[model samples]
Target: MSPLNMFSRLKNRKSSATASQHGSLPPIDKPMPSQCVSSPPVLPAATMHVKQSLQPAAVMQPKPATAAAPKPGSTDTVRSVVVHAKKLGSGAYGAVHLGTCYSTDGSVHCVAVKVISAERMRLESLSREASILKRLSRAGHPSAVRFYGWFSPGSKKVSTDATGPELTNLEVSHCLVMDRLSGGELFEYVLARKGLSEREAAPFLRQIAEGLAHAHSLGVAHRDLKLENVLISASPSGDDICKVCDFGLAYRYEVDGSGKVLKGRPLTETCGSKSYAAPEVLEGRGYDGFDADVWSCGICLFAMLAGFFPLDEATGADWRFERVKLATQHRQSATRTIFSFYDRPCQLSSQVVDMIDGMILVQPNRRLKTEDVLQSMWVIDDTIKADYADEYMYDEAPRYRGQAGSFDPNAVSGYGGQQDMAPLYRGAPAGVIAAPPPLMKQLAVLGQ
Candidate 1:
């Protein structure tokens, strides 16, 4: 069966009872809230099993836009830009449309214009997102989407009624221009393929890891990492290149202060797709943005390989919590059960299982960091070896050093030279690496 058909069947199966009571699913275009509240406390390694209460949502009131001088390298101003009538997609903030930008020399280029309504999004949030995109653009990672510029249409151009004016004449509150990825969303790509083999999925996963590693190295954390947010490139053959996009929930976790790695105040806003969120995030505890990103990556990888979520709320309960509960009951058995949840038991290799295990561990402190993931056995296996060896495999920018708002592209070279690991093994030799302590403790806790 086609992936779309299969997904429809699965979705129908999950929501059938609810549908009978409520009629049907809500409209797809329903807008989500603009802001969400997060708690303050990092999930320490020692208290892995403790449950935390959910925090109240913190609403960030809209702030008026301030008039300020444009910073160096900022494309805050443009000579002429035209947004096309074609709508690419829409979300809580706004809709995206195809656009054309013209330069002083009369050069024209196609771009994606993300238009946000003035009423729904706060100016502060828009500005923050713009800054993050600029930083990502400066970092120059191949897998990161390129940022063009942003603008807001004047009142003369905006129309409140659809019958009042054409879309071209409608005034927008904020418009961010970026390179248009023609291959569409990663979710669509996955749905088209149904499920991918380990070999087929490795390169895409590696590119995403490299992108995240580069972002983390620069102290940026993508709080909302999921299949939907990833954009696939139009590749003629082999796997399509994945570009990390949609910085709506992304934040910089560290400040660039004279070569020092200074931590910014921890983010306390709980926002992200629930399925891909780290356990701590769902529990309403303050969490490391970087660590949460790694957890989400693990979830994405699981979906890619299994063609279904490792744990789904629609499955009648919180799958993650249940998995933890099962692991507490029987550690080894639980791990195997979770891994085999989706049919295709023999398809996964030991290294693949180990890598996922390390990534999605319940303990945030014990979860594999982006750097460790890049070096993981699964990522380095033969399937992705050539791509891994490519010059752009790793970002070369210095993590926390550079002038404010400007990156020195030549400041650093390749990742510190590291030798390749020996050929892939079926699994690590017994006792080569010990099992995680947290998992063992959970088993003990449940036994009592």
Candidate 2:
């Protein structure tokens, strides 16, 4: 399909987990092209289980555009940049849009604009996310998304068009401009095309492991690291590499119980997608963000291989509690169930299931850390070199041809900018429910 058509398809079916909702088929086990060794490979499943399980119940929904678009007045000195905007996806935060920015410099850029209305902004709030993105940017972490800048009220931009009292101006109320991810998301990619075979998924898994390891080293927890947040971007040499995005729920580990830091206080809130959330988080129990993120990654890896969630949520609250309790109580049983569920398992040189076994242990303490997981031996392959297809094609800047950097690296501190954002609550960080002691120990072991 043409890229544009695929883009439209993504928009139309994006709301439903429509990509992989159909019954499963045998896992595709094709070896990745020689050039894209860096890309992850897919694992073959012995038997495919098609029943849908715990898909993201909460898809991001955009807030109703203000009662009316922002009013344009003489004071509104809108730059009127010709930005073609289309909604990409939505979450608790708001709607993410794909936009083409036409600049006076004659440079046309494709950017992702996140639109959050005042109400939604206050509810889900991007403050913490913005802070997390900024922290990652300052650290130059390859795994985290790079922040460009934001276009919100009081910015240079005024309006997009001159129309009926300028009323339906679709006022770009504080849009976040980010590098457009042309490759889309890894989740959708795998769903459209069967996930890479075990051999194929390794390199991609390695990159993710390396990225997670690096992030953990810097004391940051991505909190959310599903296929959706992973992006494929072109390098200067035209090769695609994965870069993690979406830091709305990231937690800075080094920061004290309070949000204050040498740089600035970070925004804190108990937020995360339900399916990928660690057991502790869902139970309203306090857990280390870093450890929880690793657990989520483990769930992702299990789903990737098994084609469904390893553990299912029981129907009622009481049943649900019992399910989690049972799953946590007997880690070995849970792991065995997952192993047996996959009919066509990847032919492994070693005990591959052990790795997943360690990752999703009911006890958070026993779960693996980002670094330890990367070193787990299943994800790494020294010989593999991935040749991912070029997706986001960018024009090369002429060398020694009077070319200048189009965007200022630090011109605008997208999220780091100081604001009088009030603290939602003050105390021992609400919802700081401690993890079960056994779970905490398990997490510590996994981290070690």
In terms of TM-score, the best-performing candidate is: 1
* Per-residue accuracy of model 1 over 138-176 as CA lDDT, tens digit each: 777898888876666563222232332336434645678
The Cα local distance difference test for each model comes to 0.55, 0.44
The number of the candidate with the highest lDDT is 1
What stretches of model 2 exceed 4 Å from their correct place?
Answer: 1-82, 101-108, 158-172, 236-239, 253-270, 313-336, 339-351, 382-448
TM-score of each: 0.65, 0.57
Clashing pairs in 1: 37-58, 38-268, 158-171
Off by over 4 Å in 1: 1-78, 155-169, 235-239, 258-260, 313-320, 328-330, 333-335, 339-346, 383-448
Candidate 1 lands at a TM-score of 0.65
Residue 169, candidate 2: Cα error in Å is: 6.5
lDDT of 2 by residue, 1-448 (tens): 2111222222232232111111222332442223221111111211212122122335322121121222222122223333344567765435676665555455666767676554445422344455545555667766556555555554455334333332232463556656677878766655443334455456556667677776666556776677777777766777556777776555554443453222132222334544456666555444666667777776666554433344332112322223334443433334343232222222322223455555555567666666666654445433322222111001110001111212221321231121101111111122221110000000100110
- Candidate 1 C-alpha error for residue 130, in Å: 0.5
TM-score of 2: 0.57
